[model samples]
Target: MPSLIRPVLATGSLNRAPQPTLPADGGLVLRPWRAEDAPAVHEAYQDPLLHQWHGRSSGCEQEAAGWIARWRASWETERGAQWAVADGGTDELLGRVALRQVLLGDGVAEVAYWTVARARGRGVAVRATTALTRWALEDVGFHRLELMHSTANRASCRVATKAGFAPEGTRRSALLHPDGWHDMHLHARVRGD
Candidate 1:
């Protein structure tokens, strides 16, 4: 028996093509991850701060390649949408942005992203995330999008705020990092907001 509530998005509503590249302000484009980016991803994962925040490492280019393959496969599975934030002209990767834990029926996903060392202070994550949020909420019909980061990560708070995700509240001892459990701040944006 069907429930009373209607799905915010239909099962077959999304696709990877037709608008695969999401354009951002500045010269940034959010494109699908490529195998060639393994080296850069591997290198980015080596940053101690990134390692601490993400709690995972690429370990090698091959592993990063596997990750890229999985990111591509997610589009077909309708589980997630990941993008490589790259320069529109040079095609050099600057960061990554993703809609993770996608729930199509509910029209919700959590945003995730990271910027390379060279891109960190330049607002790459903010631009890429803003582009993705617009695409998901405006173009793709998601009802809501959420962003969460460790409270200790002040930079991420800035990115989330700048990207239009207003802080909802905090979850205590929410995530485990290498150091220990850390509290997280929840932020979100909804349709028409």
Candidate 2:
């Protein structure tokens, strides 16, 4: 008869590593959101177009605090990851870009982003999304990245296209928007490796 011992895994090895803070070009940075960002985030959420496009509600101070709290918990739990896009020089919150719904077992992740109204048309979303995708593929070791947008959101679709994501396909009634159930155009980028 032989006695067997089970192998023990290290605690850190069982957990997802924390994402690194990285800077993008044009004085833009994507880093973890600070508590002080709540006010600006709340204000950005108030934009009707953002709410309509992203399904985010207009938030008060308390709600913004709660949002930040959720973001913190998500990082701790490894369920998702969010970052606040800011001006590198002034540190002002410009918008948000998230690599969320990370399927660790599958080595895949989905990206979502929003830009403040004033920040639109400046290539902010493209730059932020590109930087995040690079981080995910190169640093985080993610094999695949996915992005989706409502077909009606031509601007967002353009951003996805410009970010080097290829159009995969469209899913009918994939998302429930303010108007109704909408079709979503799916895009994907795979790591060269």
Candidate 3:
């Protein structure tokens, strides 16, 4: 029988998407995605790890470009933010880290990421995720950030752990995949955690 009402809002500085260049150890950079990255994105989607966990593929350069366009649109609409993790030395596309399911009013969001085959086993996902998490908590002012992964995706679980998202147990059959249902592990980092 608790109350369900809430206070009214003000026009805060949370509407616009933040553009930041986050640098990590060992020469990795997280920046906004670009249309010219379409080819690299299309190629990265060919990795079996991405297919196994994400269940979707860009398939072609045009579709990849379309994906980038959608990410850009989300920024303008203040719905989501996607970043391309690149090598600082060469500026080549290494992977992608994104904050999706953004609920600005509630100060909650979800993080997801994938690295190309060449970028695997190099801490690229972990570094990029850590940088994104810092920005989300400090600069973006979200109170809670979540990282969810299929139970079978051990690599992603490690990345989440390294990024300081503590495991909060699994949700039974929470995600549907190409093969069948997947139990997803819910990991999160709160503002004061």
Candidate 4:
């Protein structure tokens, strides 16, 4: 079975260098999550909106630390990448962004994110998503990137459009939240687009 298409992006490429800190507009920086951010992460999860949309919580500072560990390790594993959205001037934790379900051979991955209540409605998600998408598609050579969210998540839909992800279609009952199953809307960006 050697007669086949080669991988679009090599696996080791991502782990070759340390994950980068991406700078976005509006004085935002997307950096690697640090150990000390555990407390802030834990507190952010307490927001009801987070539970409503994400359906998961940090539960404790220790669990949040585990999240930090897992995200940091993902870089080395080359399975995914994540960043903490911080205020460039103050270095305050504000949100998170990630490329999840990365498939190097297919040159595709899913984009996901959330912002703290204080940072919402201020375009934080849009800026972070734009920065991460550029890095993933332009710098890292991914062919396509996906942004999927519940159809009920109008905020995420707005962020996707602002970040240049074109609307694809709706996937009926694609995800389960704490409340119930939700219809998922898929938005995507191809490299040349």
What does candidate 2's lDDT look like per residue over 7-54, in tens digits?
A: 222223214566557788788999887788888888998899987888
**lDDT string, candidate 1, 59-162, tens digits:** 89999999999998888788898999999999988889998999999999999999888898998998999999998999889999999999999999999999
Tens digit of lDDT per residue, candidate 4, span 13-87? 799999999999999999998999999999999999999999998779999999999999999998999999999
After the best TM-score superposition of candidate 4, give how far the Cα of residue 26 lies from its true spot, in angstroms: 1.3
Candidate 1 vs candidate 2, lDDT winner: 1
Ranking of all candidate structures by their lDDT, best first: 4, 1, 3, 2
**Cα RMSDs of all predictions?**
1.2, 4.6, 2.7, 0.7
Q: Model 4 scores what on Cα lDDT?
A: 0.95
Which candidate leads in TM-score? 4
Q: Over all chains combined, what TM-score does candidate 1 have?
A: 0.97
Q: Write down the lDDT of every candidate, Cα atoms only.
A: 0.91, 0.82, 0.85, 0.95
My TM-score estimates for the predictions, one after another, are 0.97, 0.90, 0.91, 0.98
| Residue pairs in candidate 2 whose N, alpha carbon or C atoms collide under 3 angstroms | none
Collision pairs in model 3: none
Which candidate number would show the highest lDDT if scored against the true structure? 4
Winner of 1 and 4 under TM-score: 4
Of the two candidates 3 and 4, the one with more favorable lDDT, higher being better, is 4
